[model samples]
Target chain A: MLYFILRRILMLVPVVIGLTVIMFAIARILPGDPVALAAGPNATPAEIEALSHEFGLDQPIWTQYFHYVGGLLHGDLGTSLLTRRPVAADIAAYLPATLELVCAAMLIAVAIGIPLGLATAVWRNRWPDYLSQVVAIGAISMPRFFLGLLLQLCFAMWLMWLPLGGRLPIIVIPPPTVTGFLTIDTLLAGDLHAFTMALRHLAMPAIAMSLSPLATIMRMMRASTIEVMGQDYVMTARALGLPRGKIILKYVARNAVSATLTVIGLYFGWLLGGTVLVETVFDWPGLGLYATKAIVSQDMMPVIGVALVIGLLFVLANLVIDLLYGVINPKVRYS
Target chain B: MTGPLLSIRDLHLTMTSFDGAAHVLNGIDLTVQRGEIWGLVGESGCGKSLTGLSISRLVPTPPATYRKGEIRFEGRDILKLPLREMQDLRGKRIGMIFQDPTTNLNPAYRVGEQLIDVALAAASHDPSVLGCPPGAGRRERRRAARRLAGEMLERVGIPDAGARLDNYPHEFSGGMRQRVLIAMALIGRPDLLIADEPTTALDVSVQAQILKLLKGTVADHDIGVILITHNLGVVAETCSHVAVMYAGNIVESGPVSNVIESPAHPYTRALMAAIPTKASKRGTLKGLGGTVPNLITPPPGCRFAPRCPLAIPACTAALPGAVDLGADHRAACIRLEALEHV
Candidate 1:
């Protein structure tokens, strides 16, 4: 197991290098000049030249790439032209909020999706199955941004049940930054009111982001469970007269969940970086929002940084999934 | 406790699909006693496996409906038992092994964990077996069950049983895995074991070993077994009694020797002739002509009439009753006396 993990981590070296290349290329290829964008239209050519020289933008593309790689080795992500702060530092500030939001969304997706999937499979062709199919299809078909808007209208505007958007209300003082996750920070500080507010603020955006992954998980789980249920082991379990619940939970679900877990892992990594629309709709201060602002202002460094981080996150999520497979299925040997 | 281990009387099962209701089991009767192994021999789609599933009430409903039957396990009508009561009887009082060892043991779990689960279940029904105290904690009971599981694996001839417990089902070879399944079924020490083609997926050499293991284990446990198989040779070697089924009906059933040596029913005789023996020359093996009749609209009388060369008009008029031939042998054929001329 240790060897497997080590090998997986070692394999990431090439992937990370490839990601850096792609991130660097994407930023360089986009039409527009970071120096020119930083210097307003009123600035003279001389001023633009000085700005370009100051940021090393005047160097050859290859030279700039080597310099970027050297700086990346030292954890220096360059400066965001718009924020006038280190790109890494800006990412550090925005990343935690995105992590919290994505984690919450995943929690919702798994907690609801798995049971719903199991229910649909066990009671296949019944009303529960039909209803779940409808729900899953509807959830998958609806666009995330559109779902976010609808949720905001129904729950935030019309019903006044949840907060409209953002990470917290302006009135409540923010919790101390312990884990950089507001809910966790608030709970650590023993501030119930702040934690409750944090959850309320989190509910809508997370739901919007979760719907598609939830549907994907539900469908995958349902299909996997149906297939596993037909297995001879499950029949043996039934013939042995293992209780219905035990048979479903241990024999059926344990085998069925492996495929769903893989889907969940892929979705988890995607959600971390792909929540641009949900974050935009909710006005949440996360990496997606930061990336969006950076793109609009043509701030290339942060864009590159965000892409690199998202790529790294995807790799890490898959590693975690591979490790989890060894735990869930004994047949999966590390060797 | 005084009655036979299991008895099925007039069992009629019909499976309703979009096409129509197919009469899967037509008025079947079977009796199994302690320490006796009964082989139910038939071709595919002949309802032998379904009969085994019906005994355990494992057949899925909606698609399968019991038209009429009484499955009495230990003098109690299991078909009439409440769902909860039926569950209690399963695994604890009645155990089962299935075909395709590759698919029968769950791939995700260790072989020992699966065995321990059955052990725990059996222990729950009767605490004295595992020697759990009156108020044993969960951990204590688990330890006991684990020990029992290892012991059971050793009993089934798995070498290094203690170490092998951690191995997953995929790690074991086909025959070894079948032995593991047999261990699991017998760990519960159920009175009846339903083995549905347990050795079908194994190699020819391994098939004999698995059958021997099954026979030996059931003998030691003193449990009745319903061995469902398509191979007549396996039945003759391993079973004390045999039932020949064709198109959802048992055509002939009696002492294995009596049935094998002198088959009264024409279908059974035809089946025996189909088997290639040392005396039978190449290309001389007689194959039973015609396909198994479709159960949806089965013929009015004897199901094998269409395929029976000796079939007469009287055979199609009504289903034949079982005619006793001595030595506890019975065959459902009106032309039993006419077989002497052939």
Candidate 2:
């Protein structure tokens, strides 16, 4: 096990580097000029040239890439053109909100999806199963932006229940120091008003973000549950006069969950990709919307930065999943 | 001839699909006496496992429908019992050991946990296990669960059952897993244990060990065992009674010694001839020379008539009924008179 853990950790370096390289290349190849964007459209050519020289954009792409990669080895992520701040600073600023939202959404999804999936499998060809199928299908078919808008319309505008978007109300912007995330910082101060504001604002966006992945996970879990039910152990469990609930829990779900993990990993990576739409629709400022802003403004550094961050996340998420195989199922090892 | 602990009478199972209705098990009647091992020997698709599953009320309803039958255990019709009652009877009164040791035990669970699950499921009804009325205390239940796991593991010859109970299924070898399964089934001390091709998944060496374990386990207890296998040698070694099924019908059945020494049905003879024993020497050996008739539009008469060398005119296009050969031995064949006359 120690051997496996050490080997897995070692192997992660090249994979992370590969993802960073691909993301960096893709961001660079895409048509854009960061220096011109920074200098502004009305700026004189001399000013744009000066800005380009300042940011080292005058160097050849290869030289720039080598410099960027070399800087990355020493923990540099360049600077955001808009903020005139380090790109890593912007990520440090934004990451926690994404983490909280994504984590909360995944928790909501799996907590609901797994049991509902199992329930659907249990009541297969019945009303409950059909109902789950309908709900999942609806979630899958509908656009995330549409769902986000609908949620905002219903919950925020019509009912005036939830805050439509943003981390907190502007009136009580908690000082972000230890935790860069406004929501966490607000709660750390034991500020109930601020926490409630953060939570209310989080509702619509998180649910909107969660729906499609929830549907995907539900479908996978249901299929896997059905497949596991057909296995010999389930029959053995049944033949023992094992209770329906016990059999489902021990024999069916136990085996199915392992297969479901791969699906969950794939969906998780997809969720990172899908979150961009949710963030844009809800006007929730996170890595997704952050990337879009960078793209539109032609801020190539932040674009590369956002792409690298997300690409790293995708790589790490998959690595975390692969590592989980050993924990969930002892039969498999990294080796 | 003590009365059977379980009796499967006139068992008929049919599977209806888009193609047609396939009659899988046709009138499979057999008796399993207490403490006796009956080998249901036939190649794949013979419905031996189906017959075993029927006893526990585990057969799938729609596709694998019981066209007609009575599976009696402890003088009660299993098919007639409520699902709740049947669930109570399973694992406790009747347990099943399935084929494929790899898939038979859940991979995600620890051996001890699964054993305890079976034990507690069986013991939940017993006042002795709970040490009180229903809804036992948490601490007591936990203690009982552990003790039950230990006792079961000890019974199955797993060393350090207490410490090793937390170990997952893959940690154990194939033979060990089979032993664990046997322990799980026997934890309830069931009256009838159905072993469906128990040794088929194990290697040659492990097969012997498992068979030996099963024989010893059965001998120690008075439980009846139904050993389902296609291997004649295994049947000869372990079972007291042997029932030969062909295309879902039991064509021949009698005392194991009697069946092996002298098989009544031609299919049984063909199967016997097919297996290369010490008698059938040289590279050239006899074979039945035909596959089983398609169950969907199964031949109007004997399913094995097309393959039987001694098949008479009466054997074709005509259903054969039971021919009593005395001493509880029975065979479904038309040429019984010819054999008796000889």
Candidate 3:
């Protein structure tokens, strides 16, 4: 097990390096100069040249890449042209909100998806199963941005409930920002009022973000559960006279979960990649919103920085899934 | 013979698929006595396994419809019982083992956990296992169940049984996994055991050892066994009574010696002849040359008529009824007189 862990950790080196190279190349190849964009459209040519020189954009692309890699090795993500702040610090500020939203969305997805999936398999071809299939397909096909807008319209505008967008009401001071996540910071500060307010603000955006992942998980789990029900071990469990609930929970789900795990992990990575439109629609402050702003303003530093972090996160998520496999199935550990 | 432990009368099972309904088991009648090992012998797709499944109510239902049957266990009509009651009876009163030891045990779980699950299930139905002082915690009950599981594994000849508690099913060899399954089935101390081709997935040498283990288990516990297999040799060695099935119908049945030594039905005779002996050279060995009839549209008469060497014009006229052949033996055939002459 230790050897497996060590090998996986070692594999991350090349993956990160490859990601850095791609990010560097893409930044260099994109149209419009970052320094020129930073100088603004009304700026004189001399001012643009001075700004370009200041940012070392006058150097060759290879030299700039080396500088980026060297700075990365030293734990520096450069400065965001938009905010005039350290790129890493800006990410640290914005990332937790995205993480909080994604985590809450995942929690909602798992809570509803697994039971619905199991029910569909248990009552296959029945009304409940058909209803779930229709709901899941609709959820999967419906655009998250559209869903977010509809939810805002119904729950916020028409019903006059729920804050339309954003992490917190402007009037309430967000608890100290200790954890950067409003939900956690408020809880840590023991402010029940702030926590409730944060959760209320989180509802629409999180639900919008969760629909696609929930549908994917349900569809994957339903197919796998149906298949696992026919396995020889399920029959053995039944023959053992295990009650229906125990049989489904212990034997059937235990075996079936592994088949859908890869998809779940991939969806988790998708959530982490940031649901750009969902974030845009809700205006919840996060990396997706941050990356979009950086891209539009032609701020290459934050764009590259966000891409690298998400890439690293994807690799780590896969590693975590591998570990999860060992926990769920002992056969994987020895083999 | 002692009172029958299990009896199935006029049990019929049909599987309906998109193509058509296949009459899989056409009025299967079988009786197993206490402490007797009854081998339900047949070729592949002969419905032997289905008969065993029906006894425990384990047959998957939608496609497999029980048309008409009465499976009586301890004088209770098992088919009429509610699903909840049937669940209590399964593994506690009637244990079952299936073919393919490779897949029969769940790979995700440790072999010991699976065994302990069976023990727990048994304990729930029969509170005698809760011998703990009143109000024993779950941990204590689990510990007791684990100890029983270890003992059961040892009884089935699994080496290092205690140390191997954490081992997954894949860690064990095919034969060892079979033994684990046997331990699981027997841990419940069921009154009847149904082993469906339990040794088919094992090595040639492992087959004999498993058979011996099953025989010893049945003899020691006084458990009636319905050993389903196509191997006549296994039946001769371990089973006391034998029922020969051909295409979902029991063509002949009797005490092992009577059935094996003098098979009355043409299909049984052909099955016996098909088994090669040292005296019979490989090239000269005879085989019943026709395939099993498709159950969807089976021939009008006896299922084996197409393959029976002794088949007559009247054989195809109708399905023959079981004809008594003295000494508790019976053969389903119209050519009984001809068999006597032979």
Candidate 4:
């Protein structure tokens, strides 16, 4: 097991290198000059030339790539032209917000999706199954941004049950940062009021972000549950006279959930991308919002930094999933 | 306690699907006593496996329904038992092993974990026999069950049983997996066992070994077994009694020796003739002609009538009653007397 985990981590080296290459290439390929964008339009040609040389933009592409790689090794992500701060520092500030939102959305998706999937499978062709089918279809078919808008319209505007947008109400004093997650920070501070307010603000955006992944998880879980329930081992479990509930929980669900776990892990990586739209719509101060602002002002460093961070996060999520597989299935442990 | 381990009388099962209701088991009768291994021999789709599933009430409902039958296990009508009691009876009183060793044991769990689960379940049902104390704590009960599982695996001829307990089902070979399955089934100390083509997925050499293991286990446990198989040779070698099924009905059944030496029903005779022997030449092996009759809208009277060369008009008029042939042997055929001369 140790060997397996070590090997999986080692395999990430090439993947991280490839991600760096892509991030660098994407930043370089975009139209417009970073130096020109950084220097105001009123700046003279000589000033632009000095800024370009200072930024090392006058060097050949390969030289610039090598310089970037060297700086990356030293934890320098260059400076965001718009923010005038280190890109890594900018990412560090914004990332936790995105992480908090994504984690909450995932928690909501898994908490609801798995049970609904199992229920649908067990009560197949029944009302519960039919209801989930409608839910799954609606969740999968509707666009995330559209869903976000609809949720905001219903809960924030019409019902006034939730805050319209943003991570917290402007009137409330923000909790001191601990984990950079407002809910946890508030709880750590023993401020129940702040936590409650944060949760209320989190509800709509989280629900909107969760819907599609929840549908994917539910469909995968339902299909996997149905397939596993029909396995010969399940029949053997039935023949063993194991309690109906135990059979479903221990034998059927244990086997069925592996497939769903894979889908969840893959979706976790994709959900980071999903956050851009959701974060933009909700006006949440996160990496997605940062990336959106960077793109609008043509600030390439933060864009590259965000892409690298997301790529690294995607790899890390799958690694956790791979490790979890060994725990859930013995076959994977030996392999 | 005094009668046979299991008795099925006038058992009839029908499967209702979009097509129609198919009569899967037609007025079947079987009796299994302690220590008697009865082989139920038949071709595919002949209701042999279904009969075994019926005894355990493992057949899925909706698609399958018992039209009329009484399955008495230990003098109690299992058919009338409440769902909870029926669950207790299964795995504890009656254990079942199925075909396809590759799929029977869950791939995700260790072989021992699966075995321990059954042992725990059985102990819960009958605490006295499994040596688990009435008020044993969770850990103590688990340790006891694990020990029992290890012992059962060893009993089924798995070498290094203690170490092998941690190995998953996929790690074991086909025959080893089947042996593991047998261990799991017998872990409960069940009074009866239903082995539905338990060795069918194994190699020819592995098949004999599995059969031997099964026979030895049955003898040691003194448990009745219903060995469902398509191979007549296996039945002759391992079983004390044999029942030959065609379509949904048992055409002939008796003492294994009596049935093998002098099969009375034409279907049984045809099955025997199909077996390749030292005397039978190459290409001379007589395969039974015609497909098994569809159970849905099955031909009236004798199900094998269409395939029987000596079939008469009387055979199609009504289902023949079992005619006694002495020595506890019987065959369901009207021309028993005429066939006696042949």
**TM, chain A, every candidate:** 0.97, 0.91, 0.96, 0.96
Residue-by-residue lDDT tens digits, candidate 3, B1-342: 345899899888999988799999998888888888999999889999889888888777888999998999988899899998998898999999999999989899888898888888888888565465547788888888899888888999999999787799998999999999999898888999999999998898999999999999988999899999999999999999999998889999999999998889988888888889899986997787979899999888988888877889999999899999988799999999987888
What's the TM for chain B in candidate 4? 0.98
TM-score of the B chain in model 3?
A: 0.96
| Candidate 1 ranges with C-alpha deviation above 4 Å | A17-29, A158-161, A169-176, A190-193, B133-135, B282-285
For candidate 4, list the clashing residue pairs, or say none.
Answer: none
TM-score between model 1 and native: 0.94
Tens digit of per-residue lDDT, candidate 2, span A1-335: 66855675677578657756776676577787767777778999999898788888788877877888887787788877777888888877776777777876887788888878887888899988888899999998999889899998999899999887887777886655566555677778878788788878888888987887788778888999999899888888888878888888767886677777886777676777667788887777788888788778877677777666776677667777877876777788555
What's model 3's overall lDDT? 0.88
- lDDT (Cα, 0-100) at A327 in candidate 3: 81
lDDT of 1 by residue, B145-235 (tens): 8898889889889999999999988899999999999889888888898999988899999999988998897778888999999999999
Per-candidate Cα lDDT values, in order, are 0.90, 0.81, 0.88, 0.89
Q: Interface RMSD values for the candidates, listed in order?
A: 1.1, 1.0, 0.9, 0.9
Q: Candidate 3: DockQ?
A: 0.75
Residues A1-335 of candidate 3 have per-residue lDDT tens digits of 77887887788788778877887788877887777777788999999898787777788988988898889888889888768799999988888988888888988898888878888999999999899889999999998899999999999999978989999889888798777778889999999998999999999999998998899888888999999999898898899887788889888887778877787778778888866888899998899999999999889889888887887777777878878877887777734
Clashes within 3 Å, all models in order: 1, 2, 0, 0
Task: Looking only at chain A, give the TM-score of model 3 against the true structure.
Answer: 0.96
Q: TM-score of chain B only, all predictions?
A: 0.98, 0.94, 0.96, 0.98
Candidate 2 chain B lDDT trough over 10 residues, lowest sum = B125-134
The candidate that wins on DockQ is 2
DockQ comparisons of all candidates to the true complex: 0.74, 0.79, 0.75, 0.77
Candidate 2 ranges beyond 4 A from true positions: A1-33, A175-178, A181-183, A333-335, B1-3, B127-136, B279-281, B316-318, B340-342
